[model samples]
Every structure is written in structure tokens, then in C-alpha cells.
Target: MQDITVISMIFTTILALACLFLILSPLFKWDTYIQVSSKGKDINATKEALLTTLNEIEFEFKMDKISHADYKHLKKQYETEVASIMKEEEELMITNIDRELKDEVEKEIEAQMKTYKNKKGEGK
Candidate 1:
């Protein structure tokens, strides 16, 4: 009877701990591979998925499930998709950097113009 009681207590403790972890799970964040932007993340995920699928198709061709001609076609399509996604990501990064630099330059130019105007007014 004591053994049963001990087992029940242990089970209850484990259940409580599990509930606690579940409740706190959202509070503890871990590094995630998922991108924050849906468009970017979906594009990246599609690229990765295509790469894996291309590899699998190659394997299937070797196993006689897919013919060489069909494999070539499928591989080309996947490669094109991955390439397009990579290009988009690259362009997005370049545009973002350019925008940041442009903003910084504009701010500096404004500050310099203000200083020049102030100096001219003081000299007059």
C-alpha cells in the first residue's frame, strides 16, 4: 500500500512539473531557424525543400523510379526556384543596406546644412 502511495506521489509530481514546463514554455525562447518575415522565411524554406527534393529525385532515378530525362527536367525546375529565391534575398538585403546608408547620409547632410546656415547668420 505504501509502495502504491509513493508511486502515486511520484506520478503526481511529474505531472505537475510537466504542466509547469508547458505553462512556461513560451517565456523561454530558444534560437529558432524560422525567419521572422513570412515572405522571406517561406522563400527560404521552399529553397531548402527543393534542394532536398532534388537530391531525393536523383536517388529515385538511380533506383529506376524516375528516368534520366524526367530527372533532368525536375532538377532544372528546382534549381531555378532556388536560384530565384536566393536572388530575391540578395536584392532585399542590398536594398535594405542602401536605404540605411541613404538615410544616414541624408541626416548628415541636413545637419551640415543647418550648421552652415547658423554660421552664416552669425557672421552677418
Candidate 2:
């Protein structure tokens, strides 16, 4: 009975550790991937929301629910909103790429500077 209890305890401890590791692994390993995926999802949702709003505005205009002048103004507003959102998304992508490229170039420059300094010191 004592041997059985010991074996069961050992198995329980191992199982608990395995479960903990499984739960924590994604938090550490895939955090950045998850964040990027979430950002993409948000952008998609914003696009969909803007499109839906534009459709509604168009439907109201066609049904004569709004005056021609009002429809024209509202349509222009929606178009502007869509354009701004698209521009923001494009800017975000460009900024992310620009930042990464800048970081890489800075790292390369630092490495070259270090090498130059090392050679100068060696000559002295």
C-alpha cells in the first residue's frame, strides 16, 4: 500500500509539471506571434466596420432617407474615413519595416565601428 501511494504521488507530480509547462509554453514562445495575429485581426475588423458603415450610408441615400445634400456630405465623410483608415494601416506597415531596417543598419554600423576601433588599438 505504501509503495502504491509513493508511485501515485510521483505520477501526480510529473503530471502536474507537464500540465504547467504546457500552459506556460505558449505564453513565452508565441507571445509576439499572437500579438501580430491580434493586430491583423483588429485591422481586418476595422476595415469590415468601415465597409459596413459605407454600405448603410449608400442604402439610406438610395432609399431617399436623407436629403440629396445631406447624402452627399455623409458620403464624403464616409469616404474620407475609409481613406484615412487605409492610410493609417499602410503607414503602420511601413513604419514597422522602417524600424526593423534601421535597427539592422545601426547594428551593422556599430559592429564596423568596433572593428575599426579594435584595429586602431592594435596598431598602437
Candidate 3:
């Protein structure tokens, strides 16, 4: 009977410790809960947020909930921000395309050089 109680107590203690560790593990690794965002993704998210704001502003203006002057100012500001984000996205796309093109061109050049060398060797 005493041996059974001791075994039960040890099992309960181990189970409690395991449960506590499982519950607190995420707290120790809080940084992993956050996702790392790239610059292009950030720009796209900002643009989407700005567009939503613009839509809300337009709705408020149409509903006569905002002054004409305020609507114009806000609309202009948000539009400018959206345009800037779009330009940045376009530039990022162009940069990536250029890098890919350069890599492809290099690979093609290497392949052609190899073919030419093989043909010359065969002739000899």
C-alpha cells in the first residue's frame, strides 16, 4: 500500500510538471509568435490599409458625415500614400526581374561557352 501511494505521488508530480512546462513554453519563445515580414509584403499591407481608409473616407463624405475640406485633404493624403506604395512595389518587382534575367543570361552564356569548347575539341 505505501509503495502504491509513492508511485502515484511521483506520477502526479511528473504530470503536473509536464503540464506547467507545456503551458509556459510559448511565453519563453514569444518572438517566434511574431512572423517576419518582408519589405514588399509590408508595402502591400500598407497600401491595402490605406485603400480601406480611403473607402471609409469616401463613404463618410457621401453620407455628409465629414466636411468637404476634410474629405479632400484626407482623400489626397491617402491617395498619395497608396501611389507611393504602388511605385515601391513596382520597383521591387523590376529589381527582382532584373536579377533573375541576369542570372539566366549568365547561365546561357556559360552553356554556349561549354558547347563551343566541346565542338572545338571534337574538331581537334
Q: Local distance difference test, per candidate?
A: 0.88, 0.88, 0.91
Model 1 whole-model lDDT (C-alpha atoms)? 0.88
Weakest ten-residue segment in model 1 by summed lDDT: 28-37
Angstrom error of the Cα, residue 36, model 3: value is 6.7
Against the true structure, candidate 1 reaches a TM-score of: 0.59
Off by over 4 Å in 1: 1-37
lDDT of model 2 at position 51: 88
Per-residue C-alpha lDDT of model 3 across residues 1-124, encoded as one tens digit per residue: 9999999999999999999999998779644444354556667778899999999999999999999999999999999999988888999899999999999999999999999999999999
Per-residue lDDT, model 2, residue 118, is: 100
Candidate 2 residue-wise lDDT, 1-124, digit = tens: 9999999999999999999999889778575777677886776687789889889988998998988898889888878888887888999889999999999999999999999999999999
Candidate 3 C-alpha error for residue 35, in Å: 8.5
How well does each candidate superpose onto the true structure, as a TM-score? 0.59, 0.48, 0.71
Off by over 4 Å in 3: 1-37
Model 2 residue 121 lDDT score: 98
Pairwise lDDT winner, candidates 2 and 3: 3
